[model samples]
Target: MRPEAEPAMKPVFAKIGKPVAAKFRPDPFQLASLEAIRDADCLVMAPTGSGKTWIAEEAIRSVFQKGGRCWYASPLKALTNAKWVEFGNHFDPANVGIVTGDTKENTDAPIIVGTTEILRNQLYDAMHSGENLNCDLVILDEAHFLGDLDRGVVWEEIMIYLP
Candidate 1:
């Protein structure tokens, strides 16, 4: 297909960039997402700037508060880097870590932000080794990519294996 014949791509700007609200209020969908997360796995789908990241932050915060671990997987390494910084700022720099194809740091931190491929690879290793992923909260950002022709399998595998 010609370049212009292909579908236009959505810009991967950070949705976690909104300025802090003085008295932030959760929208209904945000509330619903949080409610669902408390019991079992949750997949939050919403328009850009609709507080999905806030739901993720809140979920991570809940696990952090309990001294549990979290795995945040982004579809791209760059977005993984952004979440690393954003999470570090929100939950203390010492608690957040980054792992991508080229960089790995603070792997022992309670909150881990990395590419989906790394997370998927970790799950595979865990499965082969008969070990479970030591994470309490698992957030898969850019989950819409599960429809992608190439990288969707990574997302599908992670979802299937994550307990």
Candidate 2:
């Protein structure tokens, strides 16, 4: 006699759902952070993948509308570059510039994106030259990296030096 055929096994995972076509809405926390930053200094602490970047974008938009400059510092070169590209797309390529140890372009753009260490060095230079950093808003991404033993000091220096 032939062996009985085994029953088909069920799939382990659920089928992927169709992508939702929903309009984007800002979260209350993001709006609050934007307002706080507009009024005074703000330290936003949220889990990764949350809308922390949205607050930064709105704040930068406000500054740009007033013809002011902005500086965005990230802990890693890759992150800085990614933001440089992302901001370029959002704010226009002509308005975005990047300055790092390896790359420097469009230094006079209204928006500058660079690594945290470069920002610290610029602060040092500005202090030595008795001049202020020509930026209205300064956003520090991956700020928790400020607690790192090796590079935390640079972040601390930036915090202390930036007005």
- The candidate scoring highest on TM-score is 2
lDDT of 2 by residue, 130-153 (tens): 999988999999888889999899
Kindly list the per-residue Cα lDDT of model 1 for residues 1-163, writing each as its tens digit: 6444223332333444667769878998898899899999888999999899999999999989999999999988888989999999999989999999999999999999999999999999999999999999999999999999998999999989997
lDDT of 1: 0.91
- Per-model lDDT: 0.91, 0.91
Clashes of 1: 0
- Determine the C-alpha RMSD for candidate 1 after optimal superposition of all C-alphas: 9.8
Q: For model 2, name the residue pairs that clash.
A: none
At residue 58, give the lDDT of candidate 1.
Answer: 94
Candidate 1: where is the Cα deviation over 4 Å? 1-21
Candidate 2 at 94: error in angstroms? Answer: 0.3
Q: Please report how far candidate 2 places residue 119 from its true position, in Å.
A: 0.5
